[model samples]
Target: MRKEFLPFARPSIGEEEIAELIDTLKSGWITTGPKVERFTAEFAAYVGGRFAVPVSSATGGLHVALLALGIGPGDEVITTPMTFVATLNTIVHCGAVPVLVDIDRATLNIRAEEIEKKITPRTKAILPVHYVGQPADLDPILEIASRRGVAVLEDAAHAVGSEYRGKRIGCFPTTSVFSFHPNKNMTTGEGGMVVTSDEAVFEKASLLKFHGMDRESWKRFAKAGSPRYDVALPGFKYNMMDIQAALGLHQLRRLEGFLVERERLARRYDEALAGVAGLILPSRVPYPVRHAWHLYTPLVDIDRLTIGRDRFMAELKARNIGTGLHYTAAHEFSYYADRFGWRPEDFPEAHFVSERIVSLPLFPGLTDGDQDDAIEAIRDVLKAFRA
Candidate 1:
């Protein structure tokens, strides 16, 4: 057993990030200043987005994006049940109902064909999550939304560097929101970005993110600016800070290197874990795309073992190998269950994967020795727990 405990994820922070943050602090203008502006512009260019609005979190970004598109009370948003509850919570906060479509068990993404069947007159948008950094089939989903006169919002929280069909994610005609949390591919401490090509949506989202103020803080307080500002509408305080963007500026520059390292570790896991007893590895779709490999989640085959998923995780923990549960089925939560009267069988694929899924460690800084230790630990646990 290893003497050190290995975490499921860790940010790859470097000296450049630290230096930029120190510079921002010494500049005496920390809250949403020049750093934030530069990061937003660079990020927009990187993602090929016409506009990018920085926010406090991905959850906040989703809320603002939904409101920007005029989604609200009595409206329905179609999404997958296999994602984090924030996806459903944001819709509920907007007084919109979340209509869940079961995920494809292999890809863990919402099925495009099944989406149309759930669309009603009240359906305003389709929010497809790029599950585990693999982009959901977008072409068909976009066609359905266009034909139905509804919108599409991408939950790209786990897909910072992912690509689908020869194009990067945010470059598409629709909108996408990406997370910059510590565990994500890159870190801005805790921040997110809403990327969109729609000029109208961008304008509305910008207004909604920073307390509905007509002028941003940096502009209002600048030498050639007026201090007076006006609030056009009620909005939340969800703007990303300059301090956060300080780190983001450097992190963005190093993202390509981070992606290469993550892919290397993920492929190592695949080679070691393939056909391993009491475990089912993640599957790839039959299309041309680049998976960001944010999390290398596998199903613990509980039926073949004396231990259940939780117990299996406990066994790994005992060996000092940490794990993570990316999500439980959204419908299985008490709030959604009580509100929608949903049962596990309502979304069978999501339910099955929810019960069995476990995220093993996969991070940019994970060394080969660390990964080998984790792999050996998993095999040991499976061998001991085999029924």
Candidate 2:
């Protein structure tokens, strides 16, 4: 065992980000201002989106996006049970019912064919997450939503640089939300962005991202500013701060490089762990796509091992290597079960993926030596139960 513990993920922050943050703080405009504006513009350009609105976090962005889409009580949002709970929480907060669908066992994303079976008159939107940074099969999902006149909202919290069919995830007309939390591929400390091509959705989301101010309320405090403002609608407090944007601006500039390094590291993991007995590696689809590779997850075949997934994690921890469970099936949680009457087998694929998935170390800053160490540690842990 190594003397130090290796974590599953860590933000790659450099002096540039620190320097930019210090400059923003010393400029006496720490709240949302010039830095936020520059960051938003740069982000829009990076992802090829028409407009981008920064917010407090992905959860806040989803809530505001649904509200902007006019999704409320008596509405249903089709989504997968394999995503983070925030996906379902946002729907409930918007007063909409979450229609659960099974995942494609390979990609662990909501299956496109399964979506049509769930659409109803109350269905207002189809929300799909790019699970673990692999873009969902959007062509079919888009076709169904378009035909049914149902809006499509992308929960791209795990996929910032992912591409679908040669187009960036946010480049199209759909409303997409991204997360900048510390554990994600990029970090703004705690922030997110909402991108859209629809002028009406862009206008509404930008206005409502803050306190429903006519324009960005941060502008009201500048030298050339208006003293009064009008509230056109009731909105949440979700605007990103200049402090957060300070980090995001530098992060955006380094994002492509970060993604390149991440790809290299993920490939190394694939090469090192390919066909290890009783371990299922992350799947690669035949369709053309660019994966951001936020987390390289693989499932453990517990039946072949001596212990359950929890004990496997503990064993790794003993060797100073940390692991992460990306998620648990949302429907299996007590609140969801009691409310929706969901059984463990309602979505069999989700339940299977949820119980076995384990996120290993995959980040831009991890070196080849570090990866070798992780592979060795995993091999040692699995040797005891190799069938």
Candidate 3:
């Protein structure tokens, strides 16, 4: 057994990040200010987006984006069941209904063909999640939206560096919200960005991000600015702070290298675990994409084992290996079930994946030796648990 436990994910913070953070602390302007502005601009340039708005979390970004797009009461937003609850919760908070779509078993993304069938007169937008860093098939989804005169918002929480066709995710025509949580490919400590090409959406989201202030509120405290400000509308407190941007400035610069290392680790897992009995490894979509490889989730064939998925995770934990459950089917939750009257059988593929998925260790800091330890531990657990 390995002497130390391996965590499922960890941020790769360097001396530069620490130094930048210290500089921000000593600069005496810790709230949202110059650093946040620089990070937002750099991130926009990096992803080729026309506008970028920084927020406290991806959930916040989603909330603002939906409102900016004029989605509200009686409106319906199409999304996948194989995602975090935040995707559904944000829609509900906007007084909108979330229409669940089934996922492709292999790619674990929302089925594009099935999406068009669910569109109704009340359907306001299509929100597709890029599951585990792979971009969803957007060409068809976007086509459907454009033809139908509805909007498309991408839940790109797990797709910071992911690419669809030849362009990066944020470069697309639709609005994309990215997470900068600690576990994500890049971290701004705890922040997110909403990137879009629509000028109206960008203007509304930027204003709504910081209490609906007329302009950049941080400038009010500067030497050449006025303390007076006006609120055009009531909005939430979702602006990203300068303290968080201190980490983001450095993280954005190193993101490309981080993605390269993560892909290396994922390929290693693929080569080592291929054809391993009782394991269903992740598969790529047929279309061209540069997968960010945020999470290496594989399903355990529990029918061939004595224990269920929870116990399988417990076995790995006992052997000094940590794992993560990326999500449970959104419809399976009590709130959605009671509100929408959904059943586990409604989306069979997502339910199956929800019950079996396990995220193994995949991070820039994970060494090959560490990977070997994880692989060995997994094999040992399967051998012991085999029915």
TM-score of each: 0.99, 0.98, 0.99
- TM-score attained by model 3: 0.99
Per-residue lDDT of model 1, residues 261-293, tens digit only: 888888899999998999999999878889998
Runs of candidate 1 exceeding 4 Å displacement: none
Residue ranges of candidate 2 with Cα displaced over 4 Å? none
Give one digit per residue, the lDDT tens place, for model 3 in 1-387: 988989999999999999999999999889899999999999999999999999999999999999999999999999999999999999999999999999998899999999999999999999999999999999999999999999999999999999999899999999999999999999998999999999999999988888899767679878899999889878889999999999999999999999999999999999999988878899999999999998999999898889888998999999899999999999999989999999999999999999999999999899999999999998998889888
**So what's the TM-score on candidate 2?**
0.98
User: Model 2, range 236-272, lDDT digits (tens) per residue?
Assistant: 7999999999999889888899889989988988888
Clash count, predicted structure 2: 0
RMSD of each: 0.7, 1.0, 0.8
Error of 1 at 289 (Å): 0.8
Backbone clashes in model 1: 0
Candidate 1 has a TM-score of 0.99
Q: In model 3, which runs have C-alpha deviations exceeding 4 angstroms?
A: none
